[model samples]
Target chain A: MNERLTYESLIAAKLEQLAPLPALADDIWARISADLDREMPTDESEAPSGGGPSLPGTGGMLWPGLGALLLAVAGLLYWYSQRSGIPVPAPSPQSVPADARPASSLPADTGSPKGIYQQPAAVARPVEAMPVPLADSAAAPSTGKLPPPVLPLPDDSRPQPAASASQEPPPGQPPATAGDKASPPPAIDTPIKKKPRGVTGISNNDYRIVPDKKDSARKKN
Target chain B: MNTPDEDIQLIIDGCIANSRKAQELLYRQFYGFAMTVAMRYSRDEMDAADILSHAFVKVFKSIQQYDAARGSFHAWLKRIVVNEGLDHIKARNRFDSPAELDQAEEVPVDHTVVEQMSAGDILQLVQKLPPATHAVFVMYAVEGYNHREIAERLNISEGTSKWHLSEARKTLQQLLQSHR
Candidate 1:
């Protein structure tokens, strides 16, 4: 009879008789509850219980450095796009040719004095500027390379009678072809003007700009 | 003393309400059972305590997801605690077993031998088995998991799970015979 003890029945019997547990340290729950208070409210769900789909937004544990890497990449893209766009230089008012004036650039609609494209004398005279891209020799402003073909401006931006607005490249017109004619060749001999000292006078005591320790050290190096 | 059902319900409600007193009561009631389970998975008592603490914290935090309709709360908690222990062993890379068990003869033992043993006395015998073999036996035989579930938990092939179970039974039979 003593030889009949199988492994399965023995395990079952032993597990049935519960073992005594030692008392936990007094400070255990106190530390656990304190840690829970800080970390639980924000993440009531992501406690890593078995057999469920994992939840998101554990910035430290789940993703580790992923959130920081994503933020850095986004910041770089924003800075690059903003920094790449240089402002188009406005042509001088006096230097513009009379033919370049927007009023004469497109053929005026003769059908109605009140034609939709007709701008009121006090309001938008360049209402007719919509159907046709404003075409004039000197009216369009050019920056650095043929600036990206200016999209047709909304009627709200009334054409300046003195300065020609930049024209959009016509269909079948590659930007490079139109750009070569419009772009003024660089004047290499043109003297570079030194930017004048701050136009507004300021006392040195107005503010202190302290360099960060690392930046200052790099500068000295 | 509260009836078992009433006590479980009260503890569930208390934990959901975030009452520290209720959590303490709940821990006191279940801690022994958890320790017994944890000790078998771990190498020693200190490691078992660490695993139990982590499992209990998870139990309290995830109490809201538990539905009594699914099964008894004790069964549900045991599953979580067992998985927690499995994960701890897996994290330390201690769960590997050889692909095959050499075919060994099964020793005959009297079923009455189990009636003579206390739970602590049996745990001592189990602790003597190699860690890998002990884990497989406890998971398959004691915990009532099938070979596939044990395979998944232990990160071994289904065949390997079966082989470990075989090795564990053989080793236990020999140990049991020696003690007799």
Candidate 2:
């Protein structure tokens, strides 16, 4: 306790005996007033010296103006999504109508331009989820075993389709023409339909189903 | 002319009303006393200035909460300044790392040596202490905060606060001995 008293008193006396503290009044007030101006910005009487006079309040329309701008941006986005035929995700899943589910839930309209683009996404599902035609089972081999299901490879490993007419189609799909083979497939999952290979008279060798290139070109034009 | 107390009361009322002139008056009135407190906790004048600015801003923003009956205005202002200084030290990431606890045994200082040194000389030596030690010493020796209050403020145990206080005295004693 004596040690504490000794040092504490000594330091206190020295601090008191020193010359008066330097005046930082003006310097500190300048800085603090600037900070005060920033915090209480609505206090026009306190705006920093040399700054332009405070502008009159806009009669509290700032929020309404911001709300209108936000609404306009939302309207524009909806219009663009409709014009481009790109589906806008509904804000709430419950608000999405039964018929308005993703394109994957709709029938594969192999005939429509929309279907052509959406087919690859459908094909990208796991093999078990794909709809195998009932006829495929009857087309199995005599030994009572089905042929191996064709699996899609990742893009790096998939063979790049050429404009060759000789590329045989999957069993259910009609033969593709040279023009149909020339157009590139959609950049998503491969458009190749799964083949149940034991179907009679189809070659035992691998075959790729090419998307209808002629139709794709027609749709693009 | 109003008494100084009455004038300060009026200033406080002006501050609550968001009067710019009243705030400037209050800041000017207290600047020296507050800066002296801040300089003790800071490493240098510039840091002291920064702490003082932040503390005054707090004072203005929270002026509505200052109750005259609880304490004098200077006591309240001093509390805010000390808190701001501690915050500055914490922000610089300096309050946590102390030398191992075993190394901080209390050292008795020769009072004659400290008495001979001017405040500026002692302040420079205190600034040379590790940041955590500096904060602990100022809170304990100068500001009269007990170990428990220091611990609560710095978010350490009382034992740790005592350890830091010891560390500060040990370092300051060494510095003073070298000066002698």
Name the candidate that leads on DockQ. 2
Q: Model 1, range B1-180, lDDT digits (tens) per residue?
A: 899898789888988877666777887777777777887777766677777778878888988998999998888888888988888777775655666543323455565776677777778777777777778777866777776787787878767766767677777777777777
* The candidate that achieves the highest lDDT relative to the unseen native structure: 2
Q: Cα lDDT of model 2 overall? A: 0.66
Per-residue CA lDDT of model 1 for A64-94, tens digit only, reads 5777789999999766544443233333333
Docking quality of model 2: it rates as acceptable
Clashing residue pairs in candidate 2, if any? none
B-chain TM-scores per prediction: 0.82, 0.93
Please, what are the lDDT tens digits per residue for candidate 2 over residues B86-137? Answer: 9999888555644435323557788888878889898888899888888988
How many pairs of residues collide in each model? Answer: 10, 0
- Looking at model 2 chain A, which ten-residue stretch has the lowest summed lDDT? A88-97
lDDT of 1 at A55: 62
Write down the TM-score for model 2.
0.54
Question: Taking the tens digit of each residue's C-alpha lDDT, what string does model 2 give over A1-221?
Answer: 31355776678656544432566667877898789878864455444245665344743676798899999999997765444334222122122222222223333334444323432444334323434333334334455432222211222233433423245555554333212323322222323356655867777444766665767577554
Tell me each candidate's TM-score.
Answer: 0.48, 0.54
lDDT of each: 0.60, 0.66
